[model samples]
Target chain A: MYNKQYLNFLSGLILLFLSHSLMANVITIEITGTPFNPIKIAVVPFQWQGQNLPPAEIASIITSDLYRSGRFNPIKETELTSKPVKGSEIVFADWEKLDVDYVVVGQLNQRNSKYEIRFELFDVFRGEQLSGYNIPSRTKQLRNNAHVISDIIYEKITGQKGDFATQVAYVTAIKKQKQLQYSLHIADSDGYNAQQIVISDEPLLSPAWSPDASKIAYVSYEDHRPLVYIQETATGKKKKVISFFKGINGAPAWSPDGKKLALTLSQGDNPDIYIIDLANNSRTRLTKSFAIDTEPAWSPDGRFIIFTSDRGGKPQLYRVPSIGGRIQRLTFDGEYNARASYSPNGQNIVMVRGEGGKFQIAVLDLGTGFLRILTPGNLDESPSFSPNGNMIIYATENQGKGILAAVSLDGSVHQRLKLQQGSVREPVWAPYGRSR
Target chain B: MNQIKLLSTGLCVLVLSGCGLFGEKVEETDITEETTQTQQQTTPSQETTQPTGQQVQPQTNNVTTNNNGNTGQQSNNAVTQGLGNRPNTQLNEIKEPITPPTERTIYFDFDKSLVRSDMQNILAKHALYLSENPRATIVLEGHADERGTREYNLALGERRARAVKQVLILQGAYADQIEMVSYGEEKPVSLSHDDESWALNRRVEFVYQGQ
Candidate 1:
């Protein structure tokens, strides 16, 4: 009887431990509208006169790039009879039978001492050429050229710009353990050729690109505390801009002119908005509130700034003059709203708002008091508007992992980047001609 | 012997009488101060009776200590304990025992911090709790939400933790405390985001670390 009792107690202990472990690893998913299926695409292998290439196969590169956009389903080589030849006598019916929406065909040719390539995008359903371009290349420029072509086709079909040619600056976990091995990564937007921009055993966050795209500013924990540093993108040389504040002194937003930055500081009792003049190294306080005042965003005109403040009994969007003066409330519909950005046209403010037990991206027309919701889910954050304000990119949780997603301004078209390993987040769409 | 016993008894009576007459008022005053202390704890609650600011009363220390592990509201009987049976007044004051408002902002790393899967449920709870308390205000304190320098990290933390606050608000947290502040590198839990500690450090904490 004693042995049986002991055995029962041991089993109970094991069950308790198992349940605890299971509960600790609970996976929470916050998926909004149905994830858009990739548009069926076939990027047949490019016929090249060269042997094995040092870089990845071009077709796979294009395929994965399209796949990561969460907008293309590439047909495997085994699933097709023959590949399309670039600039050759074409047949659209062969691709149409494969149920492909768009087909990308490319040919690599060697001339003189240099390499050149031509590619074309075809709308199989309409049976017409969608877009095509040729790149007169240098030996080292093949990958970049491929990305540019991908961007062109992506933009043509979606009627929205493509980020394929852009770079993603993110923090990646270094090891399997829980130490602070944070490596700042700059990779092709599709998560390839991931090169470490900055590697430190310190925590880093909030990477902001200079308007010139030549340098980046981010927060780092190198000195055992939060410190902001700026580094040149091309050369990794860094200069510390601010450090050693008594309280919170972070959250930096570079002005469009790249001359000044707006951020939050808590040197006093509570956090408030402040701007720093880069040329003079002087700082000015923009807001003084007893409640939390942070998350500053500049309007395109640079006339005003929007930020999250709890002064109105809750966190809501408040606009203050960029030069610093009075304040006005912009959003009042929801009890909670923060992280607001001005649309490129300066007509609407995009922000995150909570209502009906769900959080969604909301657009508030600055001229009118109209508020419209864009995405619905348990969690959707970091709503960054495209330079044109036609689309919004954000980070959201799906299937227990973080994924970068984009939605059209009209809230109709949607897409997600399918990262194979870790999660992706904090997407800032580059202005036109800035990405390449 | 009888006379000595009587004299000794008289001396004791005189000392005892002097003590009562001289010390009684001071003791009474001490009793009155305790009563006032108790009243201060109870009356302010009545004046500010909002649910979020529900009066904790004088006996909160006892209840807090007992319920620290439980994280649940204690019985009303515990509320009547005044100052007895519990120690540590400062602990109760430090803790944000009240349920936070909707849209609490958790913070994150500087350039590379990733949200460990551990924080999603805490955020979900905050979202659900915020949705339940509609009028309750919240500010998602997104420090780097402090990692980078004061300016850019401010933008980055604002973008990062504000992203978390945005998520909570989207999940149903009131846009209130759901507000975000990027301390950038101004505030850090651990001074690193290297392997384990830095990863822990490079995150937006769901702080009721409210001022």
Candidate 2:
């Protein structure tokens, strides 16, 4: 009888150990990474309804896009016993057995030199297509169309809007001894279909997109010095919009209304805060200190501008009225804080802060003043919020090479968007979200 | 004479005991000689001194001067921290022998405007020299980085001259000489983002033009 009692106790202890181990693994997978909730998505390959293959690879592109987002688990084609190529052919039993919650299917057709892409979103359990659309496209617009489809699927499944159709403006450098080649490129946020909008053998830095996403303003070395240029997005055409005065021409921040810009200028002897009107082209100086001031960002309401200044000794964030009034300092914890971007909600600000000689992205609550570092990388900078403010894109170094990276606003997940070849730097997130 | 002789005898005894002091002095001399020889043997080509924090100060300045033209170029990696939004201001301090002025004079047009082509040459030279020197830093004071809104012109003025600097480095300038700083027509070289004033105001000038 005593022997039977001891055996029972041992069996209970063994069962507890196994259960504890399984639970720990599950908790670590979700807790350590992004806000990923283990979403199950069925990505059916796009079928070409046209006689010839489309100019773009639609399914591969969408697969790459969703996979890179870190929010979904796209089922693999090899794992399935059978696959469906179109919405009409889908078998819900096959998807259900694979434990997929959502299914995507699409077809491509070309007519009269224009392409039409039809895609459908479906709920696996309901066995019904949830949403479907047919959109016109051009050969040049195929990849962009794929981005749009991905955006739609993402919003429908995640309940948050997507920014896949947005344009990312960045600088690329090719250096050979004393010669440096700099090009300003605008492309899909995934770094596809990138076209060189402005190419200078000089240094190009700081590319800012307009609120309407129709234009890009950037610093170029065309005149052998740092000058600002505005370029139309549709055409590569450009004009010198601003030039030298004093100190340095750096850090251009556009207002929410697309009417004015907040920039750093040293023409007044010190790099101070200033505002310029795009209509009459006039100036109103806001700051009068001798400290180094730069990197301005506007609130969504367009009433205030946040900027970086060393007035308090180290670089910190400060806010001033857009109409030129009293300035209030915002950040105080770290010795250095600069390059701040406002979230879509305008309740928080994302910026690069230095701690222990390394730089990382940090979000500051405008309401509570709570600051939290977002990334662990040493050189993260230029944090830009997504349209919904759920994700942030910034510049960081990987293995000593400069590339753009994205992370969840809550610091739960990390993803990298690197160039297939060469070096890429300076990523500017689009304001109007992605293109249609 | 007997008392004097007794006192002199006592003094001799005292003097004899002082011989221990001489022996100690000899020992110290032997140690000094040995140390000097060991130092000479170890460092026969140059004199040596214990290096402290103060010793590095003058050497650091000398090394910086020796690298005068290249020091700024070497630190170009620092600007990588800008990732995408930060400006490459480190290039400005590379080769600039002259001190930058607190203010600059950018020219503009009246009523009708654009960044004049003539200004390109000056801006190019500033960018080229600044980037090459990497240490000769200058701020491209943008009267407009553009001239749309107060905020828009702020971005425009910064863009106008930065566009120039981008071109300059392409023409073989260093990243050092030119910094993109927009005054947004506030301290207008011509006081406008207007066609005329905008033309002039939409300019960036070297802070230390003459220098």
Candidate 3:
């Protein structure tokens, strides 16, 4: 029934990748570090059935999403042998001849004032439809629907949950009229559809998303002092949770349950980790050391909290029970290690490892304690693992400008999300936890 | 005979404390201005006779924690006991003219928080002014360069601020007279990313609130 409705509105499909050049202000992605062999796939452009152009290019978005993941090599449009709108029409022998292991085809139909996107994924060798979906969409949500389909196709093939539909919140700073304008921007993981959720003249740091992805917990120095606040993503409503301690009040991280925020606060002497209960704003001190202890991150199970501390003569990663218990040092291989957060599986941790003054992102395996350096850096920091634990997004200096970048867990693929203007830093990848 | 005896006593003091500059001799209690870090070399115990609260060691230790009077001394007990917001009492009076130090920003080496020897005299001058005026208050705004992670730099900034606060208190400034805040790498006076700018950014500024 849906295909018959689509056949009437069907407009001839145009070549992929060349139909539309995005708006001027969009972030440009520069990908590097492709492994020797990645799974090759082709995403055929979806045929649209409407008087005008379809609201989005579903197949193009999915193709790029997979390409950016560093696990797949998407076939370019110029090399494609066909643009089939249905999985049944794709010639398996032709795709196999092109060395395309997997092929995706889809169609869009506008009916009764709403659009429906239907797509199918096929394995060329098996010559069968692996996954198919018919998703209803609104006009403005076309981009999101595309990402949703990307996530679906991604998980079906890779056996890992797709975080492509997740959002990334980061702090952007630009000097306007000699005054620094700092804005907190939340954008799609692909650096598309970015919206500024909060703006202030003072610097903003450490944007953490609530487990449910409804609110953003961040540190802002708007009143000339750092304070922790959780702002709703939908509405701009904000609630200040942390008190104005005499010293440092910063680095807010939410617990897995979203009921508490693991914060680094310096009341007077030095910075230490404290968990602030959201219900009553009651805080529980987790670590007590005269040395600096900040950047607290909770395990996936919320059983223990790991933080960066200099208690052992030099800075390193340390962990303590969530409710407070014996503290154990986690990293021993580096002279300086700080700003650590656990992976989704809670097996490996990523951190900014400093050697002398040069800092780089590194992942430490909990079982092996083996530290693997991920990026070449004079300064690469603020790493957050994708919900699937496959990629790490962080902020680094690109051409002397602060920008956001991502790397696969094994350091196979690298992508820099370069902004058109201004400098961006302190990007935190939000957890989708979506079963979709 | 008294003159010769004083001269011999001064020489004996100098011999006992090698190269002791008069004010530096007050290592135990860094009394105020009258004792010009003149190295105790300036004059023999001239300012010692003057009585003050924190200085003039023979006086009362009761005012030791005048900062204890308010600002929730409970906060001093636990790191988060003062979670409930409490406003700090601001001393509004302009401070006495002891000629504050020209060098206001004390710069630190990368990630190092120790107060350098050269900055001691400058810290002493500010401490002297604060000690003389009981109502005077200053905010030590700590900062770090954009080199490391923001949270770690936040801790580093606080470390620098605390180190300066300790030194000032040792130099006779009241704890209540100094309020410390670390901005970390957030507010940089120099936007440029380089060695010189980072050096300028990693500093603690003495913002005299009552000035």
Prediction 2: B-chain TM-score: 0.39
lDDT of 2 by residue, A345-404 (tens): 899999888777577889999899799898998767767887777778887766645677
**After best superposition, candidate 1 residue B55: deviation in angstroms?**
50
lDDT to native, each model: 0.63, 0.66, 0.82
- Quick one: ranking by DockQ, best first? 3, 1, 2
List model 3 lDDT by residue over B1-211, tens digit each: 9999999999897765542233222233422223122222322432233343222122222122213222222345443212122222222222244656678998998888998887788888888888887688899988999987898888888889889999999989999989888888988899877899999999999998846
Q: List the residue pairs that clash in candidate 3.
A: A9-A49, B21-B39, B21-B40, B22-B39, B22-B40, B22-B41, B23-B39, B23-B40
Error of 1 at A110 (Å): 7.3
- Candidate 2 ranges beyond 4 A from true positions: A1-35, A49-54, A109-115, A433-436, B1-211
Pairwise TM-score winner, candidates 1 and 2: 2
For model 3, what TM-score is found for chain B?
0.53
Error of 1 at A24 (Å): 32
Fnat scores for every prediction: 0.07, 0.06, 0.83
lDDT of each residue in A1-436, candidate 1, tens digit only:
9999999988887776666544423322222332255578888888776533322246666765555454556778789778767635457787778788888888887765577777888888887888887788775566667777777877887787665666656654333365536667665544445567887776566677676666778767677555668898778999877764644555677788889888877752467898999898899899987667877888888889898887886678899999999899888778668778888788998887766545577889878788888776555666777654666777665675556677766675566654555544455554443554
Candidate 1, which segments miss by more than 4 Å at Cα?
Answer: A1-45, A52-83, A92-104, A109-116, A121-131, A136-141, A154-162, A173-178, A355-377, A386-391, A398-403, A406-427, A430-436, B1-211
Worst 10 residues of 1 chain A by lDDT: A26-35
Instruction: Indicate the residue-level lDDT of A203 in model 2.
Output: 65
Q: Over the stretch A283-369, how does candidate 3's per-residue lDDT look in tens digits? A: 899888889998999999999999988888888999999999999988887678999999999999999998977889999999987
The regions of model 3 sitting more than 4 angstroms off are: A1-24, A48-55, A108-114, A433-436, B1-99
RMSD of each: 20.6, 25.6, 19.8
Model 3 per-residue lDDT at A223: 74
